[model samples]
Target: MQAPQREEIHLNVPSYKKNRSGIAKFVVLPELIKSLLSLAHGNADVECGFSENAALITDDRSSLSDISINGLRATKDAVKFYGQGKVHKVPICKGLLDNVKEAHSRYQVDQEITQRILEKKEAIVAAAKLTKHKELVLVGKEQNLIGQRKILQEDLENVSKMLNEGNSRLEATVATKNFAGVEMAQLLIGGAKKKLDVLKTQLGDNSDQMNQLKKN
Candidate 1:
């Protein structure tokens, strides 16, 4: 049935609704009504497609079959592609219309699968780069530690030589049997020993760490 015209809705005169003239439609002819019912019944299946689409946009989401969703996307693509004159660029399958929408639908599914594969490949490459960056950072830390360890060892060796020289000088002073010289040499030797002990402790810790690093 046709709806009210725009002018009819704008009319606010008292006579329109008072005379029951606002309601324009009443009895539909029998054959016309029958034909309308038949058309509505036949169009039910088409309208049901909107129900599926409605679910996609609504809070009560529903899952459609893969084939159905693919075909739907392909249909949208088909319209745009045909408008741009690119639909014929594709190799039309034999008896495409006869086989329903399978011709374009299978292509859409394949394209989707290919896109997913490309995305996965990109993810893998990104992960690999991250792992490599972590490894590089670890290597830099190890190199810094090794350099610090070598410096500590060299300091320890230099302190050992200085301590040995002090001990030798102390012995020479003692050989002279001079009390003042002995006291001075002993003080120097004591200071040398203290420095030597600290160096030895540092070297010991560094050696242990180097050993562990080697094992790893």
Candidate 2:
């Protein structure tokens, strides 16, 4: 009995024997079968549309819009279906004539809407460019001010050191009771003090300017 069951499960088993054994196992089929079945048998409809569009949109009518193309195709289809493909045979009713008359007004409205949208986009792009230009200018100014501030700081440090050394020399000359040395040292110290004050003023002004720039 087991041998007979095993023989029935085999794919090479006779059809009559397999039917007698009930359902038999099946191997997985390739996906190609499903894909081939789903594919279109022909592109006749697509080709027909392409031919009609090519015939309607000639070199003279190359500038036709999508709406115009759709309208032309729709009118062609209507004539074919109702008038046996004859434009003269198609009946012209009052409603159709009225719609034709209103087409110019509708076209004007569409043009106005399109123009407004284009102008709005142009305005947005211009504003963005202007903003970018301002940012670049501001960064440049900040960098220039920062460079000036660094130079002023270095000058201030040098002047301050010179003033300190001159004061020390003046004090030593006074202690030694050297009249000529004292007079020369006093003159040097006074000059150093004046330069130090000027540098301090410049450094302060530079800092204030940088702060102002940052605020802006």
Candidate 3:
């Protein structure tokens, strides 16, 4: 009247009932059970170390050598655990505790010295960057002065050409004996020549100043 019974398996009892899935319904993962059972105190240890490590290895510490940093961190963790009464976790023996203590003290001193060296290196790098910035500013100023000098020289040449053209035209007009409009033409030409001369003088002075700046 009843089907043959499958073997019953029990959680931690080695005998329990199985569901249709063929797994022991009363059985559970041992590790999961242990973890759940340990929650009797309803407290958990948050691994703050992951976040601390993330913060510590910021942009500045990202460049640290992996091997050297790993060694330092390992030693630091051992010291912290030992100080926190977790000495059993650390591979330290009571017989050599004195030697380990002395070594830890020396490690602390070396860490302080390393910290100072890093600070000095940062200061030196900052100073070099400041000097480089000053040099760049000076170079930009020189380039600007040179460009102004070039512009002034070009302007002087243009004014000189205009002055020469005015003089040549006046001479041609005189040769033609154009008496009717000669006076007005001469006035206009003279005015233009005067303005051109003034401009030429200014440009020439600017050119000289530019050359002086170049020498300096």
Number of the predicted model whose TM-score against the real structure is largest = 2
Candidate 3 similarity to native, TM-score: 0.42
Give the alpha carbon lDDT tens digit for every residue of 1-216 in model 2.
445543344434343232445753332322334455567879998999999999999999999989899989999899998789998988899987998899999999989998999999999999999999988988998898889878878887787777787778878878987667776767777887888788778878878877887887
Residue 75 in candidate 2 has what lDDT?
A: 91
lDDT string for model 1 (1-216, tens) is: 898754454453232343346554323444454464456537777786676567444454346556667567566566566555366564466675656667578768878997999999999999999999977876776787789878877877776777777777778877877656766667777877898788778778877876766665
For each candidate in the order shown, give its overall lDDT on alpha carbons. Answer: 0.68, 0.79, 0.67
Off-target runs (Cα >4 Å) in candidate 3 are 1-108, 177-216
**Model 3, span 30-90: residue lDDT tens:** 5455565556453233455566466557897787666556765676676677766364566
lDDT of 1 at 166: 71
- The local distance difference test score of model 1 is 0.68
All models, RMSD in angstroms? 15.3, 9.2, 12.2
